[model samples]
Target: MTTPVEPPVPPADTAPPRPGRKLGPIADGVGSVHRAWLEPLRHTYLTSGLTLSDLSIRVPLAKSKISELLRGCGLYPRWEIMHSLSIQLQLPSWPLHRLWRQAAFEAQKSSEWVERSGDKAAVTTSLVPPLDHRAFRETVESDYSLYAQVFLDDDQRDTAVSNAFDILWLRWNEALASPDIRRFAWEALRATVMARTPHIDGRPEFGAAAFDTVALQHLTTETERMDQMAESLHLFKAMSWLPDRQLDVMVMRRLYGTSPEAVSDLLGLSLATVRSDERHANHFLQSVICPTPETEGKTA
Candidate 1:
């Protein structure tokens, strides 16, 4: 009798076919999935004890393509390719699917921007930059001193500064990698400060007083200074009530000392829009703080 033939067994680590999981709609933004992919993919590949070449053979994809997936270089693979790899690597479908979606979105966004700007270099690379905490701390700490003068108590200032730095450090690498350096830096610190200050949620009040103090230092008349201070305080308080977009523009202009042109660029708005928002915010504040005769009569 002929020897019975045994069936070929799949590799021991090969993921068995499981019930297919449905993927959720892809999230917007470039790093949405890329950040999620980095750790899980690395850990799974390492645990499988497979080399790059071996993985290519098993997945039946080119080595370069495998490297792209592994590195999350912002190049998305098709759903079929992702499905095949999901089975081969035994990774959770959601992670791979999400990665594919983010990469695809980023690729499309980059393509459109490149067409508009005609500048290939404007497209951001996936390479993460090294963070220099010492440098960042040195630069921000002095600014934080001015910050402390307004909101933070003497004892709480250092602690708040440390905490703010800790929170911002999380996004430091990402900020360094982005093309919009000024806006990224401004936003990172703004977010950190907002998170720490619960009382004035979106108002940039802490530094506003400092800017006002400097600009108003030359006023010799105590009466004039007092009037200005009152007006400033009223405007500052009114900031908490302003619409979100108008508040952003007003704070960037009056508090942060950013020019209207810079505000326009930072906010991705036209100069006219920035100025108009500033005017609207100022008018609203005036209506509340220094009401006209008609508004007073109406209130009466």
Candidate 2:
């Protein structure tokens, strides 16, 4: 019998590219809403081993359009395209639909436009939130509301907190996979509130907000009020200069009277780290607001 000859193996350099290899990372400077949904879609596409051609066939989008979507280039995609892509990728459609709506709003698309396009997508899911998500919201809502109210009116504070929860819902899978869900949630909440907060000289401006603080509002005598206002101004200025983590610790521990253990849990920090941050913040504020002769001389 004649011996069979095997074909030569291709060199690694000349081998065919892996599925989805041409899909680049999402473009920089995409808005948060775009980043939030694009990341998971990209991840799902990569893992699904689907190439652009395959996706184009399955998603009713052109290959070039699919490429643009994966890279976050071109115009913000409509809900119909996103829904079709999500179905092909086997991703949950509800979160993507919500994120699409938010992105549409960010893009200055009107409610009528969103509703009309959403009608085209024809996506529907239960209105009820997941039990764990609801529990997480309940657990953090009080502290988050209080913190936001420090920088915003009641209406604005509620809106910020609600938006934060919506963001968390969009990234629920990633949050669950994170090392600390509390820290993830805290960051989302902080970003949402700060995006609406007024800043001066790159620091959060507290002048007007501080005047409305419960501590300041409760002062009775003029002398006491004047003294308190002066001290508070100095304190808030110094507090603004504190590093972000230390500032958070100080706000929770001193301003809100949260226990170290609770602050630790809330911030996803260890108790020791919380205590250390508290001590450091206290020392820094003291040095700034009440410098001794030696410190004053050094600064001078």
Best candidate (score: TM-score): 2
Model 1 stretches with alpha carbons more than 4 Å out = 1-168, 172-184, 198-212, 255-257, 264-273, 293-300
Cand. 1 Cα-lDDT: 0.54
Query: CA shift at 295, candidate 2, in angstroms?
Result: 3.6
Encode model 2's per-residue lDDT on 219-269: one tens digit a residue: 899888878877777787778887878987877776677888888877777
Instruction: Report the lDDT tens digits of candidate 1 across residue range 1-300.
Output: 111222343354444332323212223442533444444455455555566666678776786667666665445555555555556666545434434444455466454533343232122234222346556566456655444445555554564455444433434444455444334554544443444454655454443463355446778888878877877776677776777568778767776677787666555456777888999888887777778987666423
The 0-to-1 C-alpha lDDT of every candidate, in the order given, reads 0.54, 0.76
TM-score of 2: 0.79
TM-scores, in order shown? 0.42, 0.79
Which runs of model 2 end up more than 4 angstroms from their true locations?
A: 1-29, 32-54, 89-92, 123-125, 293-300
Q: RMSD in angstroms, all models?
A: 20.1, 11.2
